[model samples]
Target chain A: MRPGRRIAGWVFIAPALIVIGVFFLLPVLLAVGLSLTDFDIYALASLRNLQFVGLDNYLAVLRMGLFWRALGNTLYFVVVGVPLSIGAALGAALLVHSRLARCRGFFRVALFTPVVTNLIAVAVIWKYLFQTRYGIVNFVLGRFGVHPVDWLGDPHMAMPTIILFALWKNFGYAMIIVLAGLQAIPDELYEAARLDGASAWRQLRHITLPLLGPTLMTVGLLTMVGYFQLFAEPYVMTEGGPLQSTLSVLYLMYNQGFDWWNLGLASAIAFVLFVFTLAATGLLVRAGRRKGWV
Target chain B: MNRARAAAWTVNGLLAVLALVTLFPLLWMLSVSLMPQGSASTFPPPLLPAHPTLANYRTLFVAADLGRYLLNSLIVSGGITLGALVCNLLAGYAFAKLRFAGRDRVFGLLLAALVIPSQVAMMPLFLLVRELHIVDSYAGVILPALASIFGIYLVRQYARAIPDEMLEAARIDGAGELRIFLRVVLPLLKPIILTLTILTFLTAWNDFMWPLIVLTGNHHFTLPIALASLAREHNPDVEMLMAGSVVTVVPVLLLFLLLQRYYIQGLLLGSVKR
Candidate 1:
């Protein structure tokens, strides 16, 4: 690696670096700058409206009623959806990794199928499936003599329905990762546990779960990062409707940026979301390291 | 032995049933797509269509605007796949084996940046694209993804496996840097390129949020967008929606089926952090 060859290396990689810098890195930095000032469509007409407001946009977004509502909805989604996602993934992994699971290839493919499907298409199908009047979900409820409830049209039900969709769409990803983890565990440990008169559940708690900590941690972090970016579900199935109950932070940023053309406020919201993800990821890494898991 | 065998059998039985549960909605989607109008919602939830028909497909092609959406998806996905492959491969090779200034620091920065969500860039990026006057164009959607950090990272990881002596010998033969890259490196990197190709294609093909915001006109909508629009337009037409779903999923599904070995291998390689 000579000094002149060093120049060649940079030249070879320069195009990608430049593009990402312009589109990705520069935008991130610009977003921070935009958040500090008052920029909007009005500002676009003449640069006069763009004044340095110095945290004014963040203060404004924080004080706005809709912003709080969106944050609450996003938190509700992450709190509920994250656990459901992990739980389903764990369950599916257990079933598939079990000794009795014959034709394992077929089962793995079947479980992973939903993950690769288009979210928009599936969310569309799910919306109709849960429709209040003629939906098969309500129809099945009718058979059980339970009253029909509007799943997407009701604000309370809308977020829950979206969470369910998220869980279904995503759980398989973690399932595969965990299954791979399970497969990596040595069989001798389980055999020894069995010989020691440990029950199936006990063996699982002591051996299987402890070994799976790293995989689950990875799954958890990825799921949290993904859940924080909840937009497409609300956009498709609920449209952040029924009193804006399903409006995630990303969704809020979008509506503000594109719909209202309030770039400053939207950029603030984007920065806030990024900070939240950073904090959450940091906490996850710390916890993993503390537990000697990472 | 007998007791353990029975338990394993029971476990296998449960898994088979669970697998069926997982696949039911997709299979039902297909069945409903083929069912005659007003035929999918009967009691007992028709396991199979009484009489399968291609009317829904015909309706999608002729009545709905899905064909245009499909074309839009093709252009967007194809452009990103081809463009990103070139950028990522060149950068990856440079990062892996070539001598570069600030190489380690730059690669490390890219790795660290992976933790940051891309949505953070969206607000300003939209404004940037709008300024460029490429807003709502295929280029606007395609350009951002043309150089993916993850793709470069994946290729770098694979490229490291190429023995250094091979490159050294090429250098000893007085081959130029790009010549060594084209002749010696790329041929060894074929399998990974194919894997990355499928991965990038699927990712670009399935993108929803960005396109949803950028492409405002129906003429520029992708298949997912069109399906979503049609679902909103004709909510009562379950069969029609199913037909749209079939259109949206079948090509990627076929591609996956054909190249599953590589797909799974790519997944393992891309996901597992070293």
Candidate 2:
């Protein structure tokens, strides 16, 4: 290329490169450095107050009881939420894909409304719906002679309630993706199955499931990673309360970094969360490959 | 209904019922937002108000100062959209078309960087924002979001399909690179530009965590942050909270409804690798 054109190319790319390099890439590298120090409110006061602690932050995070509890809580959310979300999405996708279904566009919009709405706002609506004494949920259950359950107030129930909320808010996204996958399946395969005297259930098992393996794996991975970052729901709905049952690893990191100004510890927590997400994604990919799905 | 028809109708009926269940909370939020104060907390929570009114919405704007937060959200989201559009489009176009040394290598590096989640950089980014003295300012939120890897990738993917021969023709006619980009390239790229705009705007508008951390004062709080803090302060006022929820949710919902084809196209474009 000519010098003028080469300079133009450089100019075109320079602004984005500068911003990403400074704000994103630089901070990631500096976060590693920050994680090695004993940075806190004292360090915030004076740069001189900071002390390089050489993996002490990671060690302390691993040793802390709250860290483990937060990890467990986050794991519970991912383990329970991802499957339930994928199940709901798959069901919705199949129903929408069914020949019998009517007003497909309307159903798609209605289901997808939750995904686009502001999370904090919908979380507030859910907070009231799950209220203890006068909540609509319990009020409806009362008609069936069932007692009221403290949905968000009970330690045991808080995580479950949040899980239900997560499933509701997110399934639409997965459904859309799965729907695309469903549409890509060849009609000849289903025709061949029908000729072989296969029932609908058998068709779904033998043909649809196998065909959808890659899509479902992607859906599962995305949902699991998203669920692992469970902060906003508990933050808005329960405040990580009711004996801290709703506290997630990301939430713990937020509290440590933003609330307490323990930047080093929070950086360590963020790395741990990253590692968890990476390993989970790797495992799912490996499992999918072993089954000859990907 | 005949047997097969009955079965199909049964499936449709089941789908309708499920859709209703899915929509109930949002519909109830709208219904309750118009109810008299404290009426939503009543037993068997009224699905619709007997005497509907706009008192809660009025309270939100007048008493709770939600209008200011809405304005703040608009400013922050709008600024990010415009800035991110320029940066991502330029960089993405350059990546797709412009020949330079190490271009593919740099693009590969950017793609690899996508694996490092944004939250990992939050602590240091916060300190960096603090040092730049942009903490609690719109700049702090908007500046950091001006160049996302996903946004750049989306534009690059779209820009790659633009025929290089057209650009070469323009250049042979003595059209400078900037002129060709502005007149010829941008017109052809209009569809993807609209998709990128809507995607960036919605993401910026609905973003919570970073804005929550950066903006310290109420005057600067976005709608999500304001609504979150309001839920904490006015925990018992169900009608008011629903009004707040409605206000926060309606605009984006309307946007999605109107431009759903483009939105869904963009979503599928991002997700499915062809």
Candidate 3:
């Protein structure tokens, strides 16, 4: 390339590159450094109080029972939420993509509305809807002779409630993606199958599922990565609470870093969360690759 | 033919039920927002307000300072959208069309870095913002979000389809790179631009954690942050909170309704094309 062209190239990219480098890349490196130091409120007051503690924060986090609880809660959310979310998305997508479906456009838009709404706002709305005494959900259940269940107030129920809220909020996104994948499958394959006395269920099992493997893997990875960052739901709905049953690792990090000014500990938690997300997604990618689906 | 009709009815019936379930909360939010204060707190949680009133909305705007928060949201979301568009478009076009040393390597590095969650950088980024003395300000919220890797990726994916010969023709006509970009490339990138605008605006408007941390003062709080803080207060007002949610959500919902075609197209292009 000519020098002028090369110079122009750099000029075009320089602004964005500089911003990303300074704000994002620099902070990530600094976070790793920050995690190693005892940078609490005292450090916030003066750099003189900061101590170079070197993995002590990570060790402390490992030994903390609350951290373990937070991890377990996050894992439970991911384990249950990811599959259910993907299933909902797939179900919605298949319904919308069905040849017999009517008002596909309206159903698609209605389902997707939650994805675009503010999570904090919706979580607050959900918190009210699941109120123990006056909630419509329990009121409806009462008609079936079932007693009112404490949805958000009960420890065992809070996490499940949050997961349900997340599924409602997010399924539309993957639904849209999966719908696109579904559309790409040729109708001729199904037509041929029908001619051979194949049922819709059999066609789906044999052809649709296999063809959608790559798309499913992609959706799974994206959904899992997103599910791992479970902060806003619990933050708004439960406040990590009713015995801290819904506290996520990210929520824990927020409390430590901002609320308590345990910046070092928070940074360590952040790194641990990042590592878990990376490892989990990495394993998914490898599995997809081995199956030749990615 | 009867069997086919039955299948159609079954599928459509199921879709209707799912749609209703999906949209109920938002519909409920709008419903309860119009209810008389404290009426929604009763048993069975009235589906529609007894007397649909704007009392809650009036209270929110007049007493709760929601209008101020709305303005803050507009400023922050608008600023980030405009700035991010310019930056991402320029860089994304350059990566796809322009040749420079280490260009591929740099782009590869960015793609690899995508897996690192943004929260990991929040602590130090907060410190950095404090150091710059922009803490508790709109600049702190807008600056960090000015460019995103995903935005760049989206633009590059769309811009790659711009024919190379067109750019070369413009270059051969004595047009500068900047002029060619402004005159030639940008018009072609309109669809993706719309997609990015809607995506960025929605993300910025709905964003909670970062702005909540950065904008420490109530005066600078965005709609989401303001609503969250209000909801967290003791003896919360249900109708008023729902009203606040309606105010926070309606603009983006309207935007999505209007331009959903572009938004969905962009979603597919960004995720599936790769």
Candidate 4:
């Protein structure tokens, strides 16, 4: 309201505005410019070598077969991992939210423990645990007359193994959110359902799931966006291999950018990933609106 | 009555099994870390060490120089947390309480920019840092993370509940805005402050990709980056690797356990409140 207060407001926000503008907003704009040029190791050695090639970087990215494979790998991960993760979270939420469940606090903390641990640390633990010969997973299966499966070493099994690891590492986050949503539902609805001689299945089908539509949609959107950025798991556990089966879009970008110093190509790849993420978010939001959930 | 009792038992039994499955890997990580070197590489790998020893931990600190990386992690994460708190708190409060021209429009622009992933900015940000001559230094890792959009949004949501009447009274007494903020607003924001501190510390400590790219030298490597490089090395020493994992994971894990109430509360506030 006062002139002094108005000046004070500007001073208060100045530090944050400077940092975001210089570091985040500026780089985003620069990335677009960087993508238009052939900025590689030669350019890194000398700025004079940088050549503005227009859309050449984007065109090269689209024409590369490895880029297609990486895109396909990322899509497969999201398509498979999103539902599995949500299903696990919802199941765990229902169990923990049950009136009859005991030690609810213990179960909640135990389930959430994985979410807090460092991703690199836990991925190391998983890589050792799924080792073909000496891993506990294979050893346990061997006793049941099942042969030891090369979980990380096989081309076909690497992505699935990485998906399982992602599911385990992440389900706790959505579980906590879903639990909050579950708590918000009034008990009166279930009580009313019971008065009509409803079965447990019928009560869930008719009431709980419907009421939870928006929460599930939110969880699905967040989980899908996260899953599409699958880099660390493959980087640590499989190194994008047995046959590049687990190579994600982000991993491909990392290799192109850092490993080879192909900055322009990497910038193009980054925009491609952003475009996919935006498309997915737009689609989800539209679906939510159509269903009147948002 | 008997049917109700049976259902309760069934539910609890199922929960116990699920908890065990969920906790086993982490428990095994701790277990394998303590095993004698090479003992864990045998058939049907042992769940617990036969003769538990600190040999692996000793190697990590002594041979691998993990203590230096541990110290690096503390410095980087702590720096980012403090800096981000100051910046986000000031801006968030301004957005919620202060009046400025085009304030809402600027806030709208920041919110829209949230969709662009951090990776999109990494290459140019790297070059920018290189130009500033801060690359391969702690400042390189700490500068870009000095503020975040989510942090400001969190603080704004919490600070909105502070009553305007109290601020008006302070202004009437000739208290400057800074004095009023320091004296009145901060104490009321204690809960969100705690939530934001824990959230920022954990995220900074666990961040891998950014630190890996920026901090190129081994001396500047944070715990996660150091552990990743070590794992990728041609080392088959499983026990030692597990020990490294333990060292990397335990601090944040313990912090989460101690302040889980605040942590979970923040999680709900961040996700569901919107």
Which candidate leads in DockQ? 3
Instruction: Give the alpha carbon lDDT tens digit for every residue of A102-137 in model 3.
Output: 888888898888999999999999998888898899
Model 1 stretches astray by more than 4 angstroms: A1-4, B1-6, B38-47, B234-236
- Model 1 iRMS (Å) reads 2.0
| Per-residue lDDT of candidate 2, residues A66-173 (tens digit) | 999999999999999999999999999998899889999889888877899899998998888888887889998988999999999999999999999998899999
Selected candidate, larger TM-score, 1 vs 3: 3
Off by over 4 Å in 2: none
Q: A1-294, model 1: which lDDT tens digit per residue?
A: 445565778887988898899999999888889898888889978778899999998888888899888888988998899979998899889988887777788888888888888888788778867878767778788899988889999888999989988887888888888888999999999999989999999998999998999888888888888898999898888778888888888999998888888888888998888888778778888999997778
lDDT of 3 by residue, B26-53 (tens): 8999999999989998876689988999
Write down the TM-score of every candidate. 0.94, 0.98, 0.98, 0.98
Worst 10 residues of 4 chain A by lDDT: A1-10
Model 3 CAPRI rating:
high
Q: Across residues B1-274, which tens digit of lDDT does each residue of candidate 4 receive?
A: 6988999998899888888877899899999999988999897678888899999999999999999999999999999999999999999899999888889998899989987899999999989999999999999999999988888889899899999999999999999999999999999999888888999999999999999999888989999999999899886688999999999999999999988898888887778533
What lDDT is reached at residue A141 by model 1? 83
State the DockQ of every prediction: 0.62, 0.79, 0.85, 0.84
Q: How much TM-score does chain B earn in each model?
A: 0.95, 0.96, 0.97, 0.97
Q: Sorted by lDDT, highest first, which candidate order results?
A: 3, 4, 2, 1
